[model samples]
Target: MLNNQKIKKMHKLALYESGEGKKHLAISNYYRSDYIGLALIKNFFLTTIAYGLLLLIYFGYRSEYLMENIHKMNLALMALQIIGLYIIMVVGYSILTYIYCSVKYAKAQKGIQEYYKGLTQMKKAYDREERRNGRITGRRTKA
Candidate 1:
């Protein structure tokens, strides 16, 4: 009565459901572009906050020197430089986030495909069993 193949598949499904399968399933629910875009947005905000904090710390550390040279400093150039650096940081992080998210989405998709394959096999095993026991006497109907 034991279906070894079905049992093995059930165990695999259970293992996946209890592990990274949950995350993969969740990720699979989103379109690739949407997932990547969301990650990019999150990275942008985090990068902006981190850059702001870095600027604040730098300013605080050089507060005395900055105050002494406040009048001599080219304020416009300093502002431009800071803005340029922030832009670069944001762009670099966004690119990395995009790539990472794309890979993650692809991996999730692959995992889901394997899970579905196992499910299909399980269904076939059940159908085979039912047919063997004469439980399914009528023509099969796809639901």
Candidate 2:
């Protein structure tokens, strides 16, 4: 039996292939949101690691300076700065990724709409030809 996620994927593929504009758009938007959410989570992990390394390097290089000001340095302030920097990096990366994905999805949707339009025209022409012939012309299954 197919799971819910698999079923949804299949439905999306059907909508895409059948060129159902409204349904496809709705489903695609859901998919895009899910993608963005996952990307944000992944970006958070990456940004944290990167910023952590940078902080380590900065502290290492400034060891003497930090030592000199150790008496005056407020631990709370330092902790807050690190936390704020991490939040900033994660948000910035997530925004950039969201924008990029949105543009790419929009372009793809346009192309899919065009494909649907062309398919519609073709079907209309086929129906018109069938009517002109006074009978359907296609393979028939044996009863």
Which model scores highest in lDDT? Answer: 1
In candidate 1, where is summed lDDT lowest over 10 consecutive residues?
A: 134-143
- List the global CA lDDT of all models: 0.91, 0.72
Number of the top-ranking candidate, with TM-score as the measure: 1
CA lDDT for candidate 1: 0.91
Which residue pairs collide in model 1, if any?
none
Can you write out model 1's per-residue Cα lDDT over 19-108, one digit (the tens) per residue?
Answer: 999999999989999899889889999999999999999999999999999999999999999999999999999988988898999899
Candidate 2: deviation at residue 56, Å? 1.6
Residues 26-130 of candidate 2: C-alpha lDDT, one tens digit per residue = 546556677667766788788888988999999999999999999998999999998998888888988987887677667667766765676666566556655
- How many residue pairs of model 2 clash at the backbone? 0
Provide TM-scores for the models: 0.92, 0.55
Candidate 2 residue-wise lDDT at 136:
50
